[model samples]
Target: MNDIPEPNNESDSSAPIHEARLWRDDGWTARVIKNEDDDGWAVEMIKDGEAEPALVGPWTMGRDKKNPKPLDTGAFNTLVKTASEVLRRHEQQLHALLHKSIAVTTDSGTINVVLDIVPDEDDPYAMLSATDEFGDAIAEVRVAPTFKLTRASAEAWIESGYRKPR
Candidate 1:
């Protein structure tokens, strides 16, 4: 399924003004975008490879409206951690849906873990991984899949844990 599509014509602004900015922590990278139309912002965390955004939610405006809280060591660190978890969970769900045949024997018995991976256009190494369960890798193709692996449930499968059968 088509979750979040990149803006077709991103406004050319030096700063993230109304665009998403990339943040890096340890090895994970997160994209923080300003929601000009809304009162909040959205964050997307990416790991190794996957499709879609890891965490897409509201962001605080700190204390000022014109200025957002600066991206510092502590703030960046916290964002990375939270974003990573979001990505991880998303990856697990996507995996489950992809491989419905593969029964994940959880305590519930025969639980499924689906996942999907959205690749980065600029860089071939980045992708968004989300899953249904917790830590399963399902749709792990390159940045972008040659074929279509689209669906919310299927997307959730990618989020779940559906690796490329490898």
Candidate 2:
């Protein structure tokens, strides 16, 4: 027997699932949606550069039956924080997988930049470190993977002098 329940198209047969989009400028994204089978809500967080979402936590219901606690400033702020964390964790993992060391041809001969990705096991945090040719640390940064790491992004970073560590 088929275990998956097929999509039932009867609109009024189930509770209406309300939809709302949550977006952030700092590479965080989420969607707050009402459950169709029950009187509940859920929030889905999608991190940057991740193929799958990090979390789908339940949302709070408002006093009124027909409406939810408005998506006010507080709500937006909380969502941003949650989504950002998710992205950070995702990036940390990718950074770990991306172990690369390269030598740059600067005016003064060549300098080696060692790239390291350290993942935060307890929390949703990741660290990227860049070391100089002599193994001296140049810069270290905590990154959120919500930013794309494609060739386009790489080219953009190079063009921008790699000032921003996303």
Candidate 3:
């Protein structure tokens, strides 16, 4: 689903309605929308500056059993925490997929080894690079994205003068 645009904060008079169906706060917005499949309500939690909701789940019905329960401070705080954690985990996973690094000690000195992957549907590949303690680039080579980067393999590559892996 596409992210909803952030509401403008400059004009309080222009703020959207804060009924039980929808509400907004400093860093998050909570909306209780109807479930199309059944006679129930679903709540969506969206973070600021994000286009899509971080979470969507079932919501409780009001005492009248005809409307959704109103969003309060306690519930809003819990939703914010849950949504923030979801975003954090997603970012970490993406970083792991795109970049990896390790440290290895050779006869000369310890070098920082890095592998960055370029994910393309037709031509996926990875770049293997090394840097000295002073952050000077020592070598770089392109290899398959699934290439295994081990200490022995990296040492061998360095010994071979950064030859392209076959």
Candidate 4:
């Protein structure tokens, strides 16, 4: 039924179970399915409470060479580890893309300028801010998400007396 929500990581949740084609364990589910591009098998690893799979790759063929190897504890554990790494890397990449900072020297001294983007469906924007060496907030302004922060831009902004950029 489409009504039942998938299992979440909780103490009372169902225990890990492994079937020939599906294995659910350690807050991850590994499913072996037919490869759409070829006449081979592929395994997909999906994290708990997530719709999209985090990793998918070719599966080892069974001895018969016509079927996929049954999912086992060792195989399932390896898949979970790989999928977790993939998710972690993706998160790091996203963080670097959305947050940027630069240092520029002014008459008063040097300050660190940072741009933090807040993505919203209806009102997407970014916070352009500056901080002193002691981590004190010097200035901040709302800017378009497309604002590109660089040393030159930061210097110009500070030189303008912290005025909002055009």
For residues 13-129, write the lDDT of model 2, one tens digit per residue.
233222334433334345566666676776666554555657777777778755444444566667767766776887776765755455665554444443444445655443444
TM-score of 4: 0.89
Extract clashing residue pairs from model 3.
3-51, 3-52
Task: Tell me the deviation in Å of residue 113 in model 1.
Answer: 17
Q: Across residues 25-115, which tens digit of lDDT does each residue of candidate 4 receive?
A: 7788888888889978899999878989999999999999988888898989889999999999999999999999998877788899999
Model number with the top TM-score: 4
Question: Per lDDT, what order, best first?
Answer: 4, 3, 2, 1
Candidate order, TM-score descending: 4, 3, 2, 1
Candidate 3 lDDT, tens digit per residue, 65-154? 987888887787788788889889998998998898888887789898898998999999999999998899998888999987878877
Give model 2's TM-score versus the native structure. 0.39
Assess the local accuracy of residue 81 in candidate 2 as a C-alpha lDDT between 0 and 100: 78
After superposing candidate 2 on the true structure, give the runs of residues whose Cα lies further than 4 Å from its correct spot: 1-30, 36-38, 45-55, 65-67, 100-166
| Candidate 4 all-Cα RMSD | 3.9
Instruction: List TM-scores for all candidates, in order.
Output: 0.39, 0.39, 0.73, 0.89
The reply for model 4, stretches above 4 Å from the true place, is 1-14
Quality of model 2 by C-alpha lDDT: 0.53
Full-model lDDT for every candidate: 0.48, 0.53, 0.80, 0.87
Candidate 1 accuracy as lDDT: 0.48
lDDT of 1 by residue, 33-147 (tens): 6765775666655553546555565555657674344445665678767877776786687775343333334443343432233344665332334333544543433334433
